[model samples]
Target: MDMTLKDLRIHKGLTQIEASRICNIPLRTYKRIESSVTYLNNPKYQYAFELLDKYVVNKNNECSFNSALVIGAGYVGLSISVLLSQYLDVTVIDINKDKVDCVNNREPLFKDKDIEDYFKNKRLRLTASLPNKELYKDKDIIIIAIPTDFNKETGLLDTSGISNLVKEIRTINKHSLIVIKSTCYVGFTDSLNDKNVMFSPEFLREGHALHDNLYPSRIIIGGDKNNKKVKEYAKLMQSCSLNRAKTLYMSTKEAEAVKLFSNTYLAMRVAYFNELDSFAMNHDIDAKSIVEGVSLDPRIGDYYNNPSFGYGGYCLPKDTDSLITQMKSISNSELISSISHSNQSRKEMIAGDIINRLNGHGVVGIYSIQSKKDSDNKRYAAILDIVSLLKDRNINVIYYQPHEMSLDDFKKQSDIILVNRYHPLLEDVKEKVYTRDLFLRD
Candidate 1:
């Protein structure tokens, strides 16, 4: 039915101001729509209304406390919380009370422009508790989004967390469909013989978590083909969609392999670009221009070609290591090991270049120690290796982020500023600043 704009506004239960705020529409235009002075005659306005309708469910009370719980409140967990909120009453349980509080207050613990509105609008509930047996008992969906750090010495993922969560869920929520979102080895999920279990691998980037979840390239679900639970779970996922993304179904083992191999491919690309940049830097060539020229070719379109210390983020580092470790056990796969070796080599090369640049006995200030630019996070930041390399040679290293550092105080304390990217603030000290960011954008 083509209802009047007033009827639609009332049905959505939004004041014109509130609707304008949520939709990014001009307040005056929204006011005109609400007042019947103007109609949403254009297709663009109609499309905007439809987009909002998809996210903010009209039947507020119809929310089924079809209880869903996300085990960890990290980026992936947060994204899933927002995505699943439409179909189920979702809650995120985390160890950190601060993170839980942020979620409960509908504030993002991390910065993601796409999810900020969802958080602010209380799309999902969040809590932090010592995870009692009762909490998981009645939940229909339980997703594990915890970190699985790779242990270099053991050559395996430290997945005691996953094991513990599985045991606990089996005891408490035997009927709940357990979805493993944590990245794991190829066959790990298949080995778990739990009845209501499946793997749904996440393909989210570090900064663009929610956007990727909402508008995913593809949704990969894995379980026994005949299981009703698996099929129903996939349908439930589709029903909550903000983006009409594609879906792929496979066995649990294949799904797990897809996640690992996908991340490893990204890591491989990063390593390739970093090495390319290194060669260009050695010859004093414009790396970015060369990359732009090469990428303009249809086969090698420009994306993810920016160079850095190495690929060291939440997914790429650990997934590559785990895939390599798992591949090594078979003795048939050699390429996976080489890919991992190349990653390590890239980091080593960056460290070697830094070491060769500095006088072995001076203090060097590291401007922004983050692994990625324009991000506050520093988990597995590749700069740590270069820092360690410098420290071992008795070179004192000072850390400072532009946002965190006071301009006057930072200049007073540092001998040389080692920046990944050149900044105007270091104009006077440019001679002492060492960086390879010929074209700074990550």
Candidate 2:
């Protein structure tokens, strides 16, 4: 029996509008396609049909690797190291001795349940060491998952570490396939001028790093797609993932573009919703109602729409700024350029709202500093920006995180409490709590 677009969409748990949006088609066109009014031969519908056909759940036979070396023990590196160790003899090298010790002890340097579980339950053939030529030489595959933080002064991604490391790796081991998992500028790999090197962008969320690696949505390997080593590396990654995610091969520059564009789009969505909340606040409208009403439209769905002080985390701020910088030479970068500004405006708006609520003359208590609930990372957290903005106005602020202080004591010490996300712990003091967390979720 032949399947229609609607059938495929329904099977995927998507509504017609959601499917249309995914296919980048109009609702009417999608309706026509579903009703068999549109011909499959039509060029407009061909790509959508192809996309649907390619949407099959990927299931591939497991592949194995003999040995691998992963540099950097940050979330990306550590998770990849653990995942690969399940099949390959993996060695993780980091500059930080504490991080190495933590990994050696089977303790994650950061908060991640999956990593903890893997350490406890899995017989991972992994070892941690400081970078050395001896450790680098014997590895069949060397993966670079180092940080490339955005440099505000240079107005570009700081790839100095990546550049220096690649040079060192080449010196130590000339034949090992180098896979870069770091977020870098577009054309960075092309600039390296090495055919043996490939770029494979990681798509793991903070706090859920290992879980995401195990059940990835997709895996993208960017390099010589026809190369045997490249294909083998892709297969190895696919086998490690619990889902056996669909893998895509493209040029390195395209892979870099994919990473930047994907993150920027998420940042844009966050800024869009924050702006919407700002508008609602200004107009005295119900922001939650507006968000819910808009989200009911299948195209919008209902994830990552929660409003906060701003879109501030390790990735979004830097990635968005890097993408904006990358687009400087381009003619039409208005929308891309506006994302960072929008995020900044949202932070300012949030601060202004809090100040207005306090009448600019009361002790304020900060609930937490982490970017998101249950996350230990405070890197570029939106709440930090809001706190800075308030302090600039000479408003005295105190903080009480459950991690640091008791809730009863926190309530007694503050006149007004500022919470980014509402918690049940604050229920007793809800009257004194000021928050924009309408949905009560991250």
Candidate 3:
């Protein structure tokens, strides 16, 4: 099959510079290939394509799964259910009636354009139902996509939900391949009593879950790599994805570590940039300009470099803390511990800066409570913490959310508005707004 340079780069999970280096070509030459300025017959283009071909899936080796039951209606589970439904008889099980109804009605529980489009146009062989013992026994594969939220008091991921689900699955079905897609502590898969159990780490962004799954950077499956069933499951996933992402098989413990460490590293990068933005802001310098200069190094590309209140999404905070909890026995954990601290400090700095701008006594209007724009999920959002901090200082606050009040009314009532990210609605009251969103993109 023919492939574009852009497709190859995304499949290999490499930046243009990295891909160019691997192909032994100049950056400009790679750009030309990526932009299709260079013809496919060109020697350099052919060479680059040949190098990327190593990562592509062999379509002839694809496998088919008859049936799959995915647990949870959240992003990870829902997206995986939809993807698998294209080729397999997929049933999504959720405890929440609302979520089940929404899926049954061909509606997405959350805001994802790709999912919305799929529901509108595609004839998916998918269904949703409440948890039942018979359903577990009927499916050929059982996927555990339940949430394992980090319990702050326990200092670890609350894996009770996963553990309970695994037990129930084992009791009902001894033949199904049980895959754990939830984020868990290291060595979580090995601790499970079932030999058929596996851990497959999911890397998806909020509001883009399905799209990311369709064109994933890489697919990592942890379990018995040599097992025929495991290999078949991996190939099934490969055939289902749009990109046919590069697949890796490793020990269960290593796969779990990959999930935690991958998220923690992203958290660290966010903290690093936030600290840079903080320093620039304190010294009255342009944070954006500094970031642009720094990102030109190619090693630190421009993606995910935008400044925010802090890294407060579903995965980063929990995964970082979970890693810290797992690394307690290790001697050198200062860097791991410091990532959480840096994030907290970043939020505190933002709150303090907003307060300082208002002279400590004024109505602070919050634009939205969601973690980021285009996302309905506000769990662990930094703005919530900032609101609490402002409230403790006896500062009056109002939410400018459209659901709560009209934009015209919100503008008239608030003395100052605080937005985590820039928006066109805040353009009218630019002088009254306080935000760290310099580049305007999320």
Highest lDDT: which candidate? 3
What ranking of all candidate models by lDDT puts the best one first?
A: 3, 2, 1
Ranking by TM-score: 3, 2, 1
TM-scores for candidates 1 onward, in order:
0.82, 0.85, 0.86
Residue 51 of model 1, lDDT score = 51
The lDDT for every candidate, in the order shown, is 0.74, 0.84, 0.85
lDDT, candidate 1, equals: 0.74
Pairing residues by index, what is the TM-score of model 3?
0.86
- Residue lDDT tens for model 3, 1-442: 2347787677556788888887888999888877876456677777788776544433322454678999998999999998777667889999999999999999879989888887886668899999888899877789999999998888888888999988887788877899999998997789886678999999999988888888888899999988778888887877666686889999888999999999999999989989999999989999999999999989999878888889897889999999999888899778988999999989889888878877999888887777678798888888888889889888899987677789988888888888878789778889988777877887
User: What TM-score should be assigned to candidate 1?
Assistant: 0.82
Better of 2 and 3 by lDDT: 3
Which regions of candidate 2 are displaced past 4 Å?
1-64, 401-404
For candidate 2, give the lDDT. Answer: 0.84
List model 1 lDDT by residue over 110-135, tens digit each: 86876786666543544445456678
**Number of residue pairs clashing in candidate 2, backbone atoms closer than 3 angstroms, sequence gap of 3 or more or interchain:** 0
True lDDT of residue 313, candidate 3: 75
Encode model 2's per-residue lDDT on 183-249: one tens digit a residue: 9989888999989899999888998888889778889999998888898998788666555478899
